[model samples]
Target: MTGARTPCINPRCRRTFKADGGSDEVVCGKCFRTLAEAVRSEHRRYWREIRKWDRRILRTADNLKVTRMAAIRDRLSWQLALHWDAEIKPRLIAPDKPESLDAFLEEVGL
Candidate 1:
């Protein structure tokens, strides 16, 4: 089967690239591979940790009410989203603040 396509993780060009699905890495036809690989590596690492935390949370929350578990999940998700935006996103953007700050936050449902 064909793989999914996504934009290169480059702020300047943001050219599209085909992701091989086997790996969560994206590299545009252009030589934005370095930056893309770096981004993918970091995201993979972060998501691994997130998964661990999420599973632990789920297990611990088994005895809690659904509402309480949901609230806890929401809090953790938003905090991680904020960190991704403030820490990881700013590096690619030229200015400290991205062109569409509110738009980004809105996407994360923050």
Candidate 2:
């Protein structure tokens, strides 16, 4: 027998899907896969940007006093947190996705 029909939970894709009797999924298979891929891509991009910043910070640290280096590290941490909260947090849709960039990097073994 065909399962009950339900609409995808993704606001951008509300296409109706057959709800499996044994599953509680709220999104269509296609949308779920697409969202998963998008999240992965975003994670990679965020990591790359973080590495670039790390390289720059290290280069600058060589010529800076200990106090100035600490300040730079603090500023970089604040900026990265702000970007993750304002930009990356909203796009995360996967149920098992990491809630923070640090967690993501850890998950990927980077």
Candidate 3:
């Protein structure tokens, strides 16, 4: 209440708050914390799902005989690729390389 006021950049939370006049922050502290947590949660969820597929692939590979290994690996690879492209890629800010949570939140306009 004592400094320059600015509205949170997050569309869902546009509450105005006092900010340092020279600060570059667009989102308020509350919205930034929430968005950061959400990004972390989503990142954990994505990796958990991917790990499930990885475990399945490992198990399938272990159980398959040498003669059928190639086909199984190909099928598993395709399944993972399909899941990523369909379910995960669209939600991510950058799928190619890992990015900081802040970057991810900013990229998604949160």
Candidate 4:
């Protein structure tokens, strides 16, 4: 049998390693750098719904902001950023996905 090797998310340090399961790993062992990061990339991967909800909000933020509804747009931006840093960002595990960091964050809910 062959061990599964994946690349780390950190562009500056995109290292690879072997693991039993999981495809397209968000961060590698070395690139994770600290306990906090590891938790975000590993611990938070369990939540699928939260990530999905966040992605939709981020996909059209700029366009939504420039639309007629200014107040609502601002509120959404603030909440998204806040929730990301607090709830979603710390649990990310999809660094190399097709969507931007925002969508990836949503996909992983980390």
Candidate 5:
């Protein structure tokens, strides 16, 4: 009954640490800040990737109408949803995106 392990977020460290809230699991606010910074740093790229996925889905709309491809489309959409939840959504906006990412967008006049 071992718990989960997460990689140490220190940029200079290569070790993994337990992250499952065990009694001995030490928490690190610095790592949390680091993770958030990394996510925010790529906000624009994340949006671009999400838009690309949208266009790809639209292009495949006709194939989805073919009945047999319906299953494949469903599977793809499910996978996409998982990706969105796990990767894409967290980096786009606050309380998701950090202030720096939003400021970056503003600077670009977006």
Candidate 6:
């Protein structure tokens, strides 16, 4: 099939190979260098956007005179953790899909 190849694991490497559907220990030379990178990319994207939202969250949380930044951070962190576990993790399996950070923020009502 046209879409069956996986990208190389090495950040500097540009390679793609067919998925052999074999054991985890089995990896092509290039993918061995960059395994699970898409997952990392997703987390980075989420956190970057969350930092932007956190500025607003803090301002809104502050205007009401909330004294617990730690609590608010913790709660938002948990919400993001759940969002990643539930929504983002599921789609990582199909990395080629049309997923976007804005869509995730919208999904989480951020």
RMSD to truth, every model: 11.4, 18.4, 16.3, 16.7, 13.6, 16.1
lDDT by residue for model 5 (61-106), tens: 5654545445555555666556545654443222333469778898
Clashes of each: 0, 0, 0, 6, 1, 4
Model 4 C-alpha lDDT per residue in residues 1-110, reported as the tens digit of each score: 37767666455555676765764545565544544664555434434434544555566567654353445445555665475455533444434446688877898898
Instruction: Tell me the tens digit of each residue's lDDT in model 3 across 39-78.
Output: 5465456556656655565666454553365555466556
Model 3 pairs in collision: none
Q: What is the alpha-carbon lDDT of model 5 when measured against the actual structure?
A: 0.51
The lDDT leader among the candidates is 2
Candidate 1 wrong stretches, greater than 4 Å: 1-4, 12-49, 57-67, 95-110
Give each model a TM-score. 0.40, 0.31, 0.28, 0.27, 0.27, 0.30
Candidate 3 CA-lDDT value: 0.55
Which prediction has more favorable TM-score, 1 or 2? Answer: 1
* Native-referenced Cα lDDT, model 1: 0.58
Inter-residue clash pairs, candidate 6:
9-30, 9-31, 9-33, 9-34
Candidate 4, residue 82: CA error in Å?
A: 14
How should the candidates be ordered by lDDT, best one leading? 2, 1, 3, 6, 4, 5
Residue 45 displacement (Å), model 1: 8.5
Error of 1 at 92 (Å): 1.3
lDDT for 98 in candidate 4 is 60
Please report, as a residue range, the 10-residue window in candidate 5 with the lowest summed lDDT.
88-97
Sorting all predicted structures by TM-score, with the top scorer first, yields 1, 2, 6, 3, 5, 4
Instruction: Please estimate how well model 6 matches the true structure, expressed as its whole-model Cα lDDT.
Output: 0.55
Cα deviation at 75, candidate 3, in Å, is 0.2
**Candidate 2's residue-wise lDDT over 15-44, tens digit each?**
876665654435455654554465546645
Clash count (model 3, backbone only): 0
Ten-residue region with minimum lDDT total, candidate 3: 88-97
Error of model 4, residue 9, in angstroms: 1.1
C-alpha lDDT of all candidate models, in order: 0.58, 0.59, 0.55, 0.53, 0.51, 0.55
